[model samples]
Target: MAYTLYYWPLPFRGIFIELLLAEAGQPFEKKSPSSIYPDHRFDRPLPGMAPPYLVEKGGLQIAQMPAIATHLAERHGLMPSGAEARAAATKAILDANDVLEEISQNGGVQMWEEESWGEFRAERLATWMRIFEETYQHHGGPFMLGEEITLADIAALGLWAPMIHALPPLEEDLKRHAPQVSALLGRLAQRPGLEAFLTAQRARDGQGYCGGEIEASLREVLGLKAEG
Candidate 1:
């Protein structure tokens, strides 16, 4: 199946869809937002504000990360069979999306202040970590939904791995508060296709998380050198 993904140059939300395609061994083309927005934005197959838009081989288009993820997961056999399981997987995907929004401070709407960032790291962030950790523990898993890996596992990986990769200090927080979640990330990283994709992604992007002044503020708070 031929697929085209439209997103920003940075990984951010698009990485989830990319990882899913990679894990499924599906080949896809990526188009940048620059190529789509303000020109074909409203007239595109699926009209949407902002990107992470997905267009299929047959000219079907989908917008929003979770919706695109669900479509791909269903098509690629990444979603589970049972209704409850599917619902759970969907919940996981949404949860991952929520985490992304939280970390990005609602799509980088406001810069992260040190005090606020500290509070988030200590409280809100820790709560999210525990939520994942507890969910993993409850399922008794090497994966999020237990024995078999699903899009949920991939979601977890997409959410945390890039954050930890871009901000190394947060790795310790994840390891401390959510060891199983950390372990799950380790297992997902070991997948040959996913690992290769991640390597190439790192080469291409290089620790650039949600770009702009908000990201600059994040780096400052973390004492990280601004991306060069």
Candidate 2:
């Protein structure tokens, strides 16, 4: 059965699924809600009107990032085989997803008002990335979770790619504190399959979905005023 991804044309949460597919070297059909008018803005695509949904075996549709990620990981043998490792991978992936949700909601930028909520969000992001760096340092061998690349590593990269673009400070943080992560991210992007995906995406849409280009998008989305 061919895998089918139902998502918006934009990266959003859908990139995680794309990463999994690319890593597994699986061929799947990409469906954008926008391409279909009845899809209604082509935005959300869940039973409860959520998105990042997937269909397998032709008709089984699943929603939510974690759900879809786990489903794909298990199906494609991307997850660890050991019970403890599997649990850890799942937990780490879900934690990364939680951070992605929080950061993405803030319009993927540092342009939000510096109020209590914004401060809290920024702090949370800092804490999450720090923890992630440490965790990767501990569990990741050549890759997060082991010498082999697992769903955990893919999830981490998927979440970090956009967040780092949105928060430029993250690049500096990665260099200073998480050089491992920075290196891993660079390696992931340069992987033959992943690089093809990145290049194809850039060719198809000039808008940067990777970390480097998201900064400008953030400025645009937040409508930042020019500095004197």
Candidate 3:
């Protein structure tokens, strides 16, 4: 089956699916809509007005990060087997998405800069981290679900990783207070497949976050080398 991912190639919302595919030990084609549309031309069909969409074999197209993630996990057996466990994992992914939406509405560029933006950003980040911390602690550390990694873990980690570019302080915060999450990231960093993908991405995108210092840190933490 040919798996084609259509996104802006920013690793923003799309990286979640990318990480899932990486951890699944599968190779898929990444199609960047922004790059194709930059010259005011089209190379493929647009998935509605949204990005980070996926088109599978038989012309099956799906959009939304959380929806795509859940679909992939269930289809590929990356999700939990037990019905209850599966429900919990799905709920956790949606919860994470809710937090992300809050951030996008308040902290993202959706609204003009205001004093509340700073407060909202901090509060929401802390809330999300705390949620993960509790889940990690309850699940017995290392991963969100359990010792065996699942889609929930990948979903949380993938969604959170790219956000580090927007909020550089989060790395320090996670390191200081949420050592478990940091440790989980360390484990994921050791995956050679993920390492290769991240290395190529950093090389092509350059160091630093947002196309600057956080990007370097991301590469370093992910065990990726800088570009020439």
User: Per-model C-alpha lDDT, please?
Assistant: 0.88, 0.69, 0.66
Which segments of model 2 are wrong by more than 4 Å?
Answer: 34-46, 106-111, 115-122, 165-169, 208-217, 220-228
- The backbone clash count of each candidate, in order, is 0, 1, 5
Which 10-residue window of candidate 3 scores lowest in summed lDDT? Answer: 206-215
Off by over 4 Å in 3: 34-49, 106-114, 207-228
Best by lDDT: 1
Name every residue pair that clashes in candidate 1.
none
Task: Give a tens-digit lDDT track for model 3, residues 54-139.
Answer: 88877667666788889888877679878877877887778766766565552344442445455754676577777777777777
lDDT of 1 at 104: 86
Predicted candidate 2 versus true structure: per-residue lDDT over 1-228, tens digit per residue = 378777765565778888889888987777864443345434433543455667776556667778889888998888899998899889877887787556544444543344634564457756777777787878886788878888888877887765555445457755665677778888888888788886775465444442223434444444543211
Give the TM-score of each candidate. 0.96, 0.78, 0.76
Model 1 per-residue lDDT tens digits across residues 117-222: 9999999999999988887888638689878889888888998999988899999999999999998899899899899999988998899988888888889999
CA shift of 72, model 2, Å: 0.9
Question: Which 10 consecutive residues of model 1 have the lowest summed lDDT?
Answer: 38-47
